[model samples]
Target chain A: MSKKRIIAVSMVLAMLLTGCGSTAATANGTEEAKVEQVGQDTTSAAEEKSSDGEVITLTWLNHYAEAGKQAWVQSVKEQFEAKYDNVVLNIETVDADSHKTILQTKLASDDAPTIFDLSSNADLQVYNEAGYLADLSDFECLANVDAGLLKEGQVDGKQVGIPIELSGYGIFYNVDMFNEYGLEEPTTLSELKNVCETLKANGITPFATPFAEAWAFSCYPRVLYDAVCWNNDGAFWEKLADRSLKFADCEDFKKQMQTVWDFHEYWGEDAFGTSWDSAQQIMANGEAAMIAHGSWAVDGITSYNPDINLGVFPMPVSEDPSECRMIKEPGQQLVLFNYQDERIMEAARNLYNLIYSQDCMRVYAEEAHQMPSVPGDYNILPALAEIVNYPAELSFSEAGLKRNDPEHEDVLFETMMNAYTGSTFDVNELVDALDTAFDNIKK
Target chain B: MRKIRISSLLYILLMLLAICIFIMPVALAVLTSFKSKPELAKSILSLPATWNLDNYKGAVERSDFLNSLKNTVAVVAPSVVIIVLCSSMSGYTVARHSRDSRALRLLDKVYLASLMIPFQILMIPVYKIYKSLHLLNTLHGMIFMLVGTSIAYSSFLYVGFVKGIPHEIEESAYMDGCSEFRCFWLITFPLLKAISATVAALHTMWLWNDFNIAVILLQKENVRTITIKQFYFFGKYTADYGMAFAAAILSMIPVVACFMFMQKYIVNGIVVGAVKS
Candidate 1:
């Protein structure tokens, strides 16, 4: 009797299951069909402009979602939409880490944003190689930007981006500490070491590297590569790319690595575990005398402690002070995606031009508090005076050769930390490992 | 009696230590959120000189707190309901027919396979598919993706739940000339209250705390989830830790509240879902 009952129950359950399965399949089919229709409608709608009595929304993507930057973007959106009655501006700001993947995916799809932020020279070249960047050589704003600065945004001599801001990186020193010690700003490698010894004797940490945040320490090697290594040979990058010149073969590379070792030696005890936020706070509170970072450090330090008196000087990476140069780069650049749609491309171009307008540039500079890349009668902030006037070298952080081995930066950082952590650190072995990694990446 | 008292004292001490270990970070975050930037620079570990409300105010304004809360609820509610309803039904069917039908066995294996696959691998393809379907940046689209991703695990829980339930109860209903549809709604579903609660509570928390899918699919600020909004507090060059902590505390309110309300159900549900599955 129990067996018979079980058989009956299974039969009823099977019947119920079959019936429900068909219903769900039908419902899903209907959903797909409706979504397909919506997709078709939007694709057709994108082709139709406001001239045809339809509002066209152009999407722009960026990674700057900070408080002040977001406010500036909102203002820009309002002003742009008001100027063009028919064009609705939609600006989407993703976090910087996720922005690259999101943009790459979107570009491959039909939903690509009209304008986006380009990360680095290497990233720009990748996009350019894919033919994804819209040629903006004829953009009106190009003429207003400094020629040297404008060249940074160019890929293969075809202008594909517009410089939005420019920043220079150097060693930010505590002006109060320097005055207390009666130490003039160091200009040469020997002078830098003497200053470190003075600070050590005075019972202050000479430098703060924040090795835990690998990218924070990466700027040291990046600037060192540009100033000490690449400065000697103009064709070094090309040779490295062709595999004829290895990282191990360069004498200057080893010297740069030695400077990194010295930096680790002078940094605070907990530098290996210090985070950016903690490091900035330490710098602001005068626990550390100097940090090798860029102009952006000023805002963070001041925000942490408004009364922080800070000064900037080029990092002495060479024996001769004359060879030392502050590493500068365009802070951010705006690029237009190749949408293959005439109306959309035209609207994007118009929006790009408007972004570089005098009023817009003023708002951007004021809100971001960074140096303006475009030509304008903008007042230089009092804090930027020391580094802005100094001789600068174009930063290679994003340049293809410097970014070849993705692991090279982190490995260099680890080697520096190991030197300070009682490890048998071998500079030659480190260079060989980087060269191997580069060769593997090339293959 | 003396020995029991001594043991109880030792247990109390251990419990207190456990409580402190768990609560210290959260307490620190709360304390840190109330500190001014200068005060934080002076000492991150010390109690604030003054209980500052400015960080909370700034965090709220910068994150668009009210809108993000609304958006989060709007996404989580529909997504959870859809996942529970569809997955429960599928689980019931597959579990009941598993013995007699190879098709159901195949379906069960497929779902089990899907559970092993990680979301990171599917993220790119999912984005492309959503874009093609015109689902990007839409609340409904987000709901759709969340439901699809969650169903496999949810159904697995439901399958175990349905199998544990005696078929005798449903058999009696069937003998009364009741339809299978009526039997499920009237008899089986009512008995599934425990597992349904588990599924609902689990998915609610998952959808609430989800960051990746929300960031990738929902690009517009107005449609962003609370997790995505919290990212805005951290800048590339500078981070406002006070404001970030404040925003974090704010985002936690709903999830904590949901858990508190479903505390009893969650405990029982997890136990039942785990042991039976």
Candidate 2:
């Protein structure tokens, strides 16, 4: 009756009506969208599915959230659903940063995904200890997978994770920029430093180290560690793990750090504030000529600039070029969960067998631009071809680090971040800190 | 008079600077949304060579803007309504009768204690409880959790505001033969409108942008809110900034409009509530 009351009532009415979504046959007229969210479960499809038959939802929590990977995953889901009409793959792809928290909560609860991805060896061990891993040691499809790659996912000598694909880290350089300056891919430590100096003199930034990102510490900095020790057949790691080696004793390790400290000068203002995304954009825009990251970065880089020409070479961390090798490791692994329901577990198995097949993995290798863990003839990214095909003596597999306790790699990443991030860089302090950290890890 | 004018001028200048500081990021997001990735990489502060609507188009397609908007509205609207209705009554009873009522006194203490516990602490337990109830990934559970977590703070605000009101307003209605419920609704409720609007507006913004509760509770793709939908734009190593900013700019519109509409009530409610009974 009153003006104030009338207005309040109408606002509530409007909110309620809007909240109760009125379905309209809305469509963007006649043009396909370039960037679209894929794998949306339509209500109509769900209804149609239930109307005719029983279709179970197999939940999967994936870590790949980028557009290029999502598109490939969307196709994979569709193909799987079409092939197996009784099961709908309820795939949820969260960004890698927050995926862990969501996943830990879900995995602990009754709502855990039947299948999930773990980014690190430490994660595999933790989840395996929690009794979440569904003893995939007997999984039949794994017969075709490389034993060495499969070992990367093994925890306590028990096969838990099914290695899906692998990605490698290298010194990514802009080929066009390198060609413009007449600089070849540097092989030795001296040549790499020389390239940085020349690029700086020519008013081009040589490296866009995304030191602001905690994960970036694992990319280029770890490559430095691997370069010094990778050639010794991981004897340095074995001794270090056994507390027999001090980081200070390795002269090459100090040389690598000194090289890093030199390269640190090439990073311009806000260097520590540079994010992985900003670093890639800077490299793509030709603001920076080089970034040391991995095979996974190619899609993101090329998406930003379609015409950008890129190439990867081994990070020259040692004076002896032969000792400097690119670091390629198994990426995320898909581990089956221990489920009680027979129907759900069967569906999970069907999905697993389908995905691990060469036909499905080809999409991952070709589109996602990473090497499949399974033995398959797939074309590697042209930019990464040199590093992937680098002469055996000049390249190292991350599976070599598998000799050391899997958890040591995580400690090394944190220690390197601490050492590199300090205002004062000291080789002795860095090595001592690393030695102490390894000692602290539970044997 | 001259001194006062000079002081006023200084205050105005200070206010403008503060406004700019607050507005700059939003302005940057808007500008970035209109630029291509190359242009954005060139300079985050520079104007675009072309006012490209393509990013907005891409974001609309990529974020499922319409469905997420519908879901956000569904969760936020009902949660705000419940929070306002429940908090107002609890606040009124606690303010008016807590001295004589033992149950209300205990509840007030419980709510006051609950406010100190952060949502991050309750995230796992709440998730587990919801899973048992088969409420995970449902709008029903999402609304319930949002209201449950928010009611404590909203009631505290109402309790503060309700205590400031004179008890004479309700007494007069009671003297005229009005029942307690009718008297409170027709008489005291109108007087409490300012705080209610404030509560509704604050909760709308908070509930709309709520990530912690919604993220854990609403994991399904179709049930995702705009905040969750926008999260997929970022990857571990890279992000599509142009499209993400576009989604941010678009999503901010409803929130901004709601805040502006209730701006008067929010300021008045806070100022009134800050005064002692």
Candidate 3:
């Protein structure tokens, strides 16, 4: 052979040998399946186990602030491990915003985690419909969960995931700031307007709304949708789900938009630029008098200033008091995947039982500053526990009610926000656009 | 004279305006990095209230900036050397021998054809091959892949430059009892310096700032490059904007520094390579 041919053949041989060596190393060192698949199997197996001595590793993925809080994850993991010596709990934290994309990619690759948290009911429905989540209908631990919370996890008569907590959003006010201005929490839409006028007159911003984060604008429409359209027959949620109702057509939605527009004057000069976290901090630091957010902000507020007196009130966007609805959605869920192994199923069931038990719920409520799904007289932080029984109008997120229709929810919310932001298009036009998007998806 | 003076003044004004416009985004990013998160959120484009180093400190800590910088250099340096050496030698042989051999001409055509294939289409197959070889997460593996992908194009350029060089130089050296390898290296290699420098600079930038390959191949935290580190700084819902910007600025520093130091070589080399090719 010529020198060139010899060199070429030698190079090819070397590359082939190197490739074989690495493949053998990877086969030996790494887990047999991808990381996500391992998570799924482990979760399913843990659910099947009856008793915990088998030492099943359960991975919990979430994007909550507490997820990144080393102290919180370690504490929860330690508590669970201590209680159930046989089941080892591993926490895989991801950012909340990025979790959906990551989860979708993993599921496509069949590498989904055995246990992952879903932020919206719509997401739970999507996963349940796709058979990605295991049905927990017969799990006794769910017996004490609130019917509403349980309903959030159900898709087509099947309970596919477990609800861990519940949260509500209205208007959380700084009591000290309110007292300084001698203002009372508005009980009616007119009173709310008057309060804003009064605060503006005193040279203080009445509300701090961050429109930059589109979700922040969601609070106004969510409460109004509940107050005006929701009925005891569940026609409100059903109409929304079926696209039989147009938010702009509803007089209540128009009134709510008016209220939102009126309050725009009091949102301060740079309201459009303020971010959700920055707005929260502004409220916590007394830079703003009130912020419209969920009960989740309680811990953050107290942490910002231990002595800052905080008060909560339902958003009274409706002229009729009886029609007012506080916006809410299901908290995170503990889901199980169907596993054939009897032992694995039993182990997972036992783990779920531990998670839902009164003891675990109490720890979750107190430490996490969250409302437990289970019925319990748990000692929660004073501010948070007090709001648990607060008589604010309640409305579930439309996203939760139409969990299977993510495309619809995205359109509805996007259109609603566009209208609220002074888009020149009429509500009918926006609704028509949504209908087109939904129809296209259905086709 | 008056019209010429006015044209020169207009040109200067336009140049200044272009520079300002080009530098605006970089200036905003640097200013925003110095601001606190609250300040950043409040006015992303405004001047910072206080110039703070906290964001930079946080970015360095979170991104492991120094480690990524080191890994980036480790990948780029050797890859540059291997590409420059291999492409130049191969280009010389191909250009010199193609005049006499049909096989050399065919090889030249193959190399040219390889350049037309998109990098994205090659990524998965390359990754699978690398994975099978256990080269997925190693700096050496990355260097090997970079060299493999870059060699053909670099060699194409080198071949063109070598073809332009007078063959009489190599012939005279061969007549002096020098071996083929010695004649080529001692005579043609020095003459190929400009093209070599151009290839080296381009590959250095490509390998140093590359995100896609590094992300797919490197799973281990210790081996991640600077771009991967920047990406990992942002999470699903929450982004450490300050740190993201700071990390971005930091990642550009080494490349910028390298470019500044070699600016003269880069310009002259590319010009020479382009003219000869």
- Could you say which candidate leads in lDDT? 2
Select the stronger candidate by DockQ from 2 and 3: 2
Q: What is the Å distance of residue A232 in model 3 from its true position?
A: 5.4
- Give DockQ for candidates 1 onward, in order: 0.35, 0.24, 0.09
Q: Indicate the worst ten consecutive residues by lDDT in candidate 2 chain B.
A: B119-128
Residue pairs with colliding backbones in model 2 are none
Winner of 2 and 3 under lDDT = 2
Give a tens-digit lDDT track for model 3, residues B1-117.
999999999999999999999999999889878877656545668888888899899889866789988998889999999999999999999988998998999999999899898
Instruction: By TM-score, rank the candidates, best first.
Output: 1, 2, 3
Model 1 Cα displacement at A203 (Å)? 2.7
Candidate 1 lDDT, A1-443, residue by residue in tens: 99989998999999788544321101111121111111222233234455569677777788887777887788889988898877888888988777766775565444557778875566567666656578899888787776667766778879887778777778888998999999988888889999999998998889876667767766656667766666666566657766789978898888787677766668888876888888888898888899888788887888888888888887887677777777667767888766666777677777877888878777766676677777577664555655556543523332223333344445545655555455446678777866775576568
What are the per-residue Cα lDDT tens digits for candidate 1 across B213-264?
A: 8988898788888999887877788878899999999888888888788878
Worst 10-residue lDDT window for candidate 3 chain B reads B231-240
RMSD of each: 7.3, 10.4, 7.9
Global lDDT for candidate 3?
Answer: 0.68
Ranking the candidates on lDDT from highest down gives: 2, 1, 3
Better of 1 and 3 by DockQ: 1
True contacts kept of each: 0.63, 0.54, 0.07
Give the per-residue lDDT digits (tens) of candidate 3, residues A1-443.
59989999999999788544331112111222232332333333233245533556665655543423334455667777887767676554444544554444434333345567765666665556556677789988888787767877877788877788877777788887778878897878788888888777877677877667776766645555454555333465456556566544566555555666656667856776776767766775666777777676666656445666888777785566665565555677777754555655666677777777887677677666678888699887665655667553454443235433445666666766666566243555555665566556556
Clashing pairs for predicted structure model 1, backbone only: none
Q: DockQ: which is higher, 1 or 2?
A: 1
Q: Supply the global lDDT for candidate 2.
A: 0.77
